[model samples]
Target chain A: MNKMKELSVNHLLGIKYISEEDIQLIFETADHFKEVINRPIKKVPSLRDVTIANLFFENSTRTRLSFELAEKRLSADVVNFSAASSSVKKGETLVDTVNNILSMKVDLVVMRHPNPGAGIFLSKNVNASIVNAGDGAHEHPTQALLDAFSIREKLGDVAGKKVVIVGDILHSRVALSNIFALQKLGASVKVCGPLTLMPKHIAHLGVEVEPNLDRALAWCDVANMLRVQNERMDNSYFPSTREYVQQYGLNLERLQKLNKEITIMHPGPINRGVEITSDVADSNQAIILNQVENGVAIRMAVLYLLASKIKNYD
Target chain B: MSQKQLLNSSEMTVTLQRLACQLVENHTTFQNSVLIGLQPRGVALAERLVEILKNDYDLTDVEFGKLDITFYRDDFRRSGKVLEANTTEIPFVVDGKRVIFIDDVLYTGRSINSALTALQSFGRPLEVELLCLIDRRFSRHLPIQPDYVGKHVDVINEEKVKVNWSEDNKENSVILIDE
Candidate 1:
């Protein structure tokens, strides 16, 4: 038997702390919680007295809902702060926001913000465990975890599997998340879009960058489509959405060109006919809904693990 | 294994021969007998028993198979269905064969429960019996028990048992621990 490579998943600054062993642990922990979630009680006493605050400075539906569900499933007391109503609108600093929240005796903080490294900065200012929900375009660790879990669960193993991520690579925290995750899970990752939308010097990020969508689509066992992220694109990521879709959109023809066995995945709120066609988006191979189910389980795993780590030492 | 036998290498070997003899006598209904090991601990114990049985008797064909219950686990997702499960294949048709499910320790029986759930995937066995290196008393969470035992001991609530084996020199022992 071949030796299994370990995964490490950490909740700190930078992507350095998460190893493959930690990824496996999170997936396993998430898998374990599926049963706990199915129960009539719908909760575990793992973090009975623990208090977790969902500190969102960005708008989201899947991430926010899943984090709250994950916390509730673990029996943790959850507090939420919508960024629009927070005192930060009153000229408060990030450190002051964190300090004020920490003073409230929260055990963990799950934050989403517009600027990259916002979660890292908040982590430095607090004693509570910090989970980066989505931090600008840098990375969404939880989303990455869920993506990897879905890929591994569906395709058996992601190691050495060819995976191509299409659409807005520059503005997507989902893209950054999938790249880190697929790479960690041993999948050969590729990112494809127009030259402008594709990351500059992208090969240095340990992924192949392709401008031709057809070649990238045929080369991968799994193709992850990223939404154009129009809301976050302050300036033109490319010349125009119509030209971008014409060149790179996953239409029925491109879908047929792909290997029938190659799975279609998207961390969705999909842009129909923009990144992918409706037919391809709703195809048999698309595991988008599965990703949503796994997201809650994955978040549940993150909470259980972080809580256990806290309890293990203290 | 009993505390004395676990500590005594010579005594451990004698009890092994005795357990093999008992298996041979009781499993007389089948022409061929196969030992299927559950993943992790069961695989090790099955490998151990095959050697002990072959050394004591002049058997021509004593078969061993590694059964990966990762896919068949009741709490597969929760148990974290790992990509690599040891492998669940008994090569021959297991129909009507007396099969021994070997494991290192018997606790809540969830592993055996998972193993039994897995065994149904292959051809049905005529009979299935449990064998363990250690029988942890008062932990019958599932409705499973070992037919053969090296030793039985009482375990406290806060205490756990760890069985360590050295494959290089073929040395195995037991350790009772608290965590």
Candidate 2:
């Protein structure tokens, strides 16, 4: 297949909306941006003329910071807005907030909303490109991209590799996006968590559901341990954290049982002792920090590619 | 379309040797000098020159790296086509060292302009020089000229100059295509 110079889609709303070639192109572009970030001077002037607005309708630490850093490293003008501080508290609509931001001539919008498909709703009404940072439990496209990138860096490639995502799959936009991204890149995916934490129709997505953590760890080449997302739990999904950890927590002892080495990944704000113990989380096999590092590069690739498509009306 | 051969294999080989000798004469041992190849096209020229310097002139410690200027170009959003980036593998710092940028052809001098900006990300160099195999005369849009030139050819804007390397499974020759 021929190499792609630009992304097939203007906005990275979800991994499912993108083609396999688009993922490959993003990876290749991220490879260059990764090198650029490691240099003595970490900034590029490619997006100097473009302006971006980050609208976070929900709480986030890494995703927001990663996107902002990615924009700053590309020399793009950035303005951040969080729902807590914004007029949304005074009953400002999503379209109104975004429209007001776009009125200032913003070229792109990087948004994380509590509601699913918020990015899609804004893209249809707005006049700029939109990147879905995380929309409820629907998709966190950049997070998934970085996770897959981290996997590719650890192993030679993602294809033909087995990946098992452990923990609250039903409440994780990361899990949904990761499944689509991994599957697109030719990797087999499995979800391992309590039946309550797992989506009912998740099997329709073509991922095997492994309830036992031990079997899931032994069967996979990489284990992406997800956060327990305590805030998203309106009702208790499991009996207790202790029970969940006893059954699902990946600790040092559990890691030693595996015959061959498997790469460990966590899109962070990791529960230190819940889904993964501190010993295993901080282990040599875990690429949690690398995933954070690759997040910037991956986001930069996304912003740069999308910004390139923002037409100059003048 | 029609094409005209600018330099054949024997002529190209002699030109390369002369260029290597000139580089060795100025930067002996190449200890404090680093060679940077502009990505995609310039890399082939830089690799060939480094090989000749190592084998024929016995300059074994020559430092070489590739730099991609796609991110530093001025025409980022101005152009319709998105610029594709190539590999950049600069392992050593360029601070306080004489750096030479090698490319296959110097046309509008825009690529060199972009290369200059891209190089600053590494470190500040003591001095910088441009070296190209073919210098397209009277067509430069920028006020830039190469310090070293293998051949100077007068060509119009519509025509193109292509340097074919034997490494790409083609005969080593420079062809000027008339479209």
Candidate 3:
């Protein structure tokens, strides 16, 4: 048998930093993990001796739990730290806090911070491999991977597919990561939202901006609905939540108007009746739940590949 | 490097017939017995044995599956290259049934150890056995010995055994290559 290849980069800071071959390799490895998770015994002993640290300087539910479960399923010892409960509350710096954790001999770090480029900063100052869970509104690499994997599972391939991301493009790490990942994999991307919520010069990123949601929905094979980040906005980007729903909400009536059925996706903690309705989220055309399930497998692939690069000090 | 042929095509056919007969002598009708082939190389050997068992002996109820042990290996970080994974297909239940692990060669006894750990994911077997085409002597790394062997040869640490099959677009033979 031929020898397997390793990933090009050691740290997964963002999708923009990795190559197209890295994404394909990750998707192939995720295919194997997807099969393993369905077996009677879901655990593997590949990372039995490795230790991982999850440092979350921001709040999250799905990303944290998904990374933890992926670590446990691979038989790796995990240590978790949150800013609310850790020394960050006492005014500790990012590099100081990570160096303190590195003193415990952690081999890999999965981190989420409120500031942009925090993972990039930690990767340069730390000795261990870093996986970016989320860095401010910059990028969520694993979420984008799982979203692409979910699309591959539903549509058989992501190449030549039209994907339109709707709502809150200005303050979404998911949107940025997904744009980078999708374009790298040969898919055309479009962003649909209000002018205020859309970023300035987003077209420079090579994505088309569609002001009307209905035209964006009719012109795509997949629709990714992003939640309105009310917490990130200092002032109201829209007049009201009711008005936002009236213009951009994905309801059954709007879906029925489209001639073709498009795959629906949403990264979790969705606001029902805001970006998407409850019925549309639970409909057959929606792959929101499948995205959650694939999240674990995608995370396992990332951890396993990174752990293979950890060399012995002695 | 120099190479020496150990077994030719005619010899391999006879040896496969004998191994099939031995399997039949032990597992009659194969009602509760399953044949598992280790992935990448062992799968070809297992498939050939299963064909002889069905075509010649008229035993059509034999349960067979393929297992991959990449994730269960012990030398993950010790090696220089990354380990690639293969497909594992086990459609039948192995609970309280006999399992016979089939492989092409038994050398160092480490791959079998990994296979043993990988088998637990399916279920517990009543008993387990091993069958191999070639057994390299003095390789008792884990105290594992094949129950049925086609041929035994004394090999050194610097030599490698290469088994070529028709399924891989090569002549059916086994050769020892000096490194």
Clash totals for all candidate models: 15, 0, 0
Evaluate model 1 with DockQ and give the value. 0.06
Stretches of candidate 2 off by over 4 Å are A1-4, B168-170
After superposition, the stretches of candidate 1 with alpha carbons farther than 4 Å from their true spots are A1-16, A39-41, B1-179
lDDT of 3 by residue, A206-239 (tens): 9999999999999999999999988998988999
How would the candidate models be sorted by TM-score, starting from the highest? 3, 2, 1
Encode model 2's per-residue lDDT on A1-314: one tens digit a residue: 11338889999999999999999989999999999999999999899999999998898899999999999999999999999997999998889889999999999999999999999998999899999999999999999999999999999999999999999999999999999999999999999999999998998999999999999999999999999999999998999999999999999999999998889999989889899999888889999999999999999999999999888843
Error of 2 at B167 (Å): 2.7
**Alpha carbon lDDT at B31, candidate 1:** 57
Residue-by-residue lDDT tens digits, candidate 2, B1-179: 99999999989999988998888888988989999999889999999998999899888879999999989988888877788888899999899989999999999899899899999999999999999999999998999999889999999999999999987423799999999
lDDT of 3 by residue, B38-120 (tens): 99899999999999999999998788999999888898877866887888998899889999999999999999999999999
CAPRI class of candidate 2: medium
Q: How does candidate 1 fare on TM-score?
A: 0.67
Summing lDDT over every window of 10 consecutive residues in candidate 1 chain A, give the lowest-scoring window.
Answer: A1-10
Residue A15, model 1: lDDT of 45
Against the true two-chain complex, what DockQ does each candidate achieve?
0.06, 0.57, 0.65
Indicate whether candidate 2 or candidate 3 has the larger lDDT: 3
